[model samples]
Structures are given as structure tokens and as C-alpha cells.
Target: MSTDVVQIETRESRLEHLPISFFASVMGLSGLALAWQKGVHVLYIASEWVSLVIAAAAALVFLTLLGLYGAKVALHPSHVVGEYRHPVKLHFFPAVSISLLLLSILALNMWPAMAMPLFAVGASLHLVLMLLVLNSWFNHDHFQTVHLNPAWFIPAVGNVLVPLSGLALGYVELSWFFFAIGIMFWIVLFTIIINRVLFHNPLPERLAPTLFILIAPPAVGFLSYVRLAGNVDAAAHILYYFALFMTLFLITQVPRLMRAAFFLSWWAYSFPLAAVTIASLTMYEKISGTAFFVISAVLLGIVTTVVTALVVRTLVAIGRGRSACPNRPARDPGRLETQ
Candidate 1:
């Protein structure tokens, strides 16, 4: 190819790859961490501090990579996926990944000193992204049976909640402002989605179930905040658990949307990972007995194993254009990097 043609091709390729590359990388980090966290339980039974340390170290590295990517995205907005078009949603992976890395570092260093800021960053950015999503949908036509791209929402919410989970550790500050903003976001997002289903444009059967899938992560975040903030009152617990269960019920339909197992979206397929995480919370709250934590932990382990393997496989397949029932072939990998 001529050099000019090659340059044009490269630029086009960069635009195409921007969206999925960030998502795949972010999901890869979450999947691997869940796997390691679950695996460590077995090894730690033997008091394997060394193994635990190594596992934690690996997690730190993963978080660092995720954070670096986020920083790159923030510095070079052109690299933001789908930035060329509406600029509706500012993908939260970059911001959330940085928050996760910082939180992890604070935890490892025993730095109560740094925990509050990390926590605030996580909590605030999460609210910001949620608001953006809400505002976008509120103004746009979200119905019309639009073909949902699982890649977009999956990593978006997952990455945000990963750090938001730190709120559970009790090392962070709570702002009523943040929570209020979050509620507004929730209001807008749900309104638009409901409007689509009920009034405006109805999603087709094929695309309909994906709506349920999109609800998973944010639902998880709601549950995670309640769980992590620790000390839920009777009313609070009841509300949170009710929402949690409903979310899980929604997640059950994901496989149906994907149809053939071979045709599952990298995003839709990974819903199980988020589902597993949600399941853990459910078990944590539902069973109040001594065996409660253990049983839930086991479920989390199984879910983690299955989800992580699936994510890794998808990454490989997408990287090589070998996905079993590929919907969209991913762009060239090199175009993911921005100068």
C-alpha cells in the first residue's frame, strides 16, 4: 500500500479499535482479579501468606495497567471510544481504573492517610459517569429497538464499580452530594429506558433482553455501596436485597439474548462475571448463618473461574478475528495506543 494510504488506513483503524480495546483491557483486569481473589481463598486455607502476597502483587500490576490506560484516555480525548460521533458518554474505564489502582495501593501500603481521597475519587467519578449516561439517554431516543452493544455498557459500569467496591472497606468518606447526584442519575437512566420500552420506541425481541444485561453492573454498584458502607438498617437491607434479587433475575436472561453460545458478545458473555459478583453479595446478605459466607464464597469462586476463562478466550479470539460467531470484527490492535 502507498504510504499515504497506509496512514489513512491507520487513522481509520485507530478510530475503530478505540472502543473495544479499552473495554477488553478493562474487562481483562476485572476478570483476572476476581479469579485471583477466589483462588487465593483455597491457597490461603493453608496459611499461604507468600502465595497471597504474590496474588495481590499480580492484582496490583493489573490495576496499574488499567489506570495507565485511563490516564492516556483522559489526556488524549480523541482516543476516547466513539468520541468522533455524539460524545454522549465519556467511558469511565480510564477514570475508574485509576481509582482502582490508587485504592489497591492504599490498601497494600496500610495508608489510612491516602484512603479517603481514593475513596472520594472512586465515588465521585462513578456518580459522574452515571449522570452522563442518564443525561444522554434522557435527551436522546433510546428506543427504536436499537441494537445494543454490550461492549459499551459492560466495561463502563464494571470498571466504575470495581473501585466503588472500596467503599465497603470503610476507609472512605461519604458525601450526601455524591449520593444525591447518583440518585438523579438513576432517575434519568431508568426514565429513558422505561420510556423506550413503554412509550417511545420498543426494542425488538433480539435486542430487548440486552437491556436487562445492561442493568447488571449499575445494579451491582447499588448493592455494593450498601454492602461496603456496611451497617444497613432493616429498611435499607430490605430495599437493597430486593433490588439485588431483581437484578440477578434480569441477568438470567443474558444467555437468551446471545442466542447461540457461539454468538455471545464479548460484553454480553461477560455479564456472568458481574452476575457472579452480584451473587456473592446476595449470598452475603441472605444467609445469616456461619456457613453463609463460605457457601457464597464458593459460588463466587465457580463464577469467577468460568467468567475469567471466557473473557481471556474472547480477548484472544477478538485479537485474531477468530471469534466463533463474531458479530463485529475488532480493529487493529496497534491503533489502540495514542501518542
Candidate 2:
């Protein structure tokens, strides 16, 4: 009691707070899911309102933070928006922009008077602009060729896919105008993506894997449209082909990127989930028998398990002071370790 005591303080991690990008990506995902769940009243189960409200809240929160980050990134004298450290040009801008608009439409579920028109306009414009930005590299003659930071492309594609369920939802309601416009935009965007992957990027070796993950948006849009149209034959064939391609790509590429463990680990863990989800969504619409349903269910379960594990792992790592730079170790005397 008479002796003096020494105290120790521990700092909390910034990542535990969740980065704006992550929040934005999640909102985009939730919005897409809700949009897909629009019709099937049974699908909503119990907490549909709660889910929509939460998604809307996430959308606004991320939008505010992303805006601030973008402004800060833009104002930097040395760094341009397309550069590596802060690659805002890729899909971040378009994803968040469309996300907010979509959330508004979703929140106005009962009232289509304003939401319907806005959703159509917003999705069409957003899809076109985003495709152009992503595929702009096809214009090799441009003054500067932006070497995309895969970080932007990866999550951004995921973000794009997040809204895809909207097409399905609208289709269920027989909102022909929105459905038609959205599909047209998606078809065009898909063409651009296909072009860029096939002709633009120099990294042919990297192309398939990246495209494998990136192509989910158009795949999703296509599936939704076909399902909406009740063209099961086409949808089933496409799903099978897509699954085959994805499986082949994943098997080949995962080993190639083995040296890039952290990045590859993230990719390996997340991408298969995406591939399966897209594949299952497509197959779910197509096949009638138990075999198809079982396969689809299994794939969906795998996707859910893998993604949830990754998210929890990421969050826990954040909590333990490994947050932003999880790759860094306490023993390492690097800048990341210092952070």
C-alpha cells in the first residue's frame, strides 16, 4: 500500500472501428440482398424492416465517411485519385453513389411513385459510368494508363454485385421498365468488362482469376433477368458454364498466388463464396430436381460458412491490434508494426 504502483496503457485499433470502405461494401451487399428479397414475402422471414433499416443506416454512415476520405485523397498534391495508395477511381465512387440511391428506393418499398423511376435511372447511369471507368484502360492511347489497384477492383466488383438482386426484385414485381433498362445497362457493362479482361490488361496471367471474381456482377444481373423472364434453360446452361470456369480458374490460380499468402488467403477465402453464390443463384432458377437443389444448397452453405469465418476472423484480428496491417507482426520493426 505504501509502495508506488506502475500502470500500463493499451491502445485500441482503428480497424476495430471498421473502415469506411468496408462499411460501404457491406451496405452495397445488404442493399443487393434486400433488393432481391423484395417479392418473396416468405423470404423476409421475420425481420425484413429491421434488415432494411440497418442497411440504410450503414449506407448513410459509409457514404459520409467515403465522401470525406475522397475529398482528402483528392486534395493531396502528390497523389491522384487513380493512384495505388488511394484508388478512388476504380469502383468506390460509383458503388457508394448507386448504393445510396438504391437504399432510398428500397426504403420507399410501399411507394413506387418516386422510387421506381429513380431506381431505374440510377442503376442505368451507375452501371454505364462504372463500366466505363473500370474498362477505360481499354483506351491505351490515353495520356496516363491507370494500373488498377486490385483492392479497388476486388471489393468494388463485390460492391457492384451487391445491387444485382435489385434486378430480380423488380422483375418479381413485373416492373418491366426498370427491368428492361437495368438489363440493357447490364448487357452493355458486361460487354465492357469482357472486353477489358480479354484485350486491355497486360497481365494475362492475372486476368482470369480477377475476371472470375469481377464478372459476378454481370453474371448476377444476367441470372436475375433470365429468372425474371423465366428462361430457365438459358440460365441453367450459363450457370453450369460459369461454375465450370470459376472452378477451373480457382484451382489453377490459387496455387499460383500461394506466395502472396495474405492477399491470396483473402482472395481464396472470399472469392469461392462469390463464385458459389452466383452459381447457385443461377442453378436455383434452372434445375428442377433434388440433385440440383442439393448442389445449390451445399454451395450456398459453403459460401456462407467461408465468408462468415473470414469476416469474424478479420474483425477479431482488428480487435487484437492487428487491424489495418494484419500482416504485420509485433516482432517486426516496420512502419506497419509501428502503426
Highest lDDT scorer: 1
Worst 10 residues of 2 by lDDT: 330-339
Regions of model 1 farther than 4 Å from truth: 1-16, 24-28, 31-84, 87-175, 198-229, 251-255, 258-265, 268-287, 290-298, 321-339
Question: Model 1 reaches what TM-score against the true structure?
Answer: 0.58
- Compared with the true structure, all predictions reach lDDT values of 0.44, 0.44
Write candidate 2's Cα lDDT for 120-214 as tens digits.
65555555655665565455344232333232343334333423345533534434444455445545655655564566654333222343444
TM-score of 2: 0.55
lDDT score, residue 53, model 1? 53
TM-score of each: 0.58, 0.55
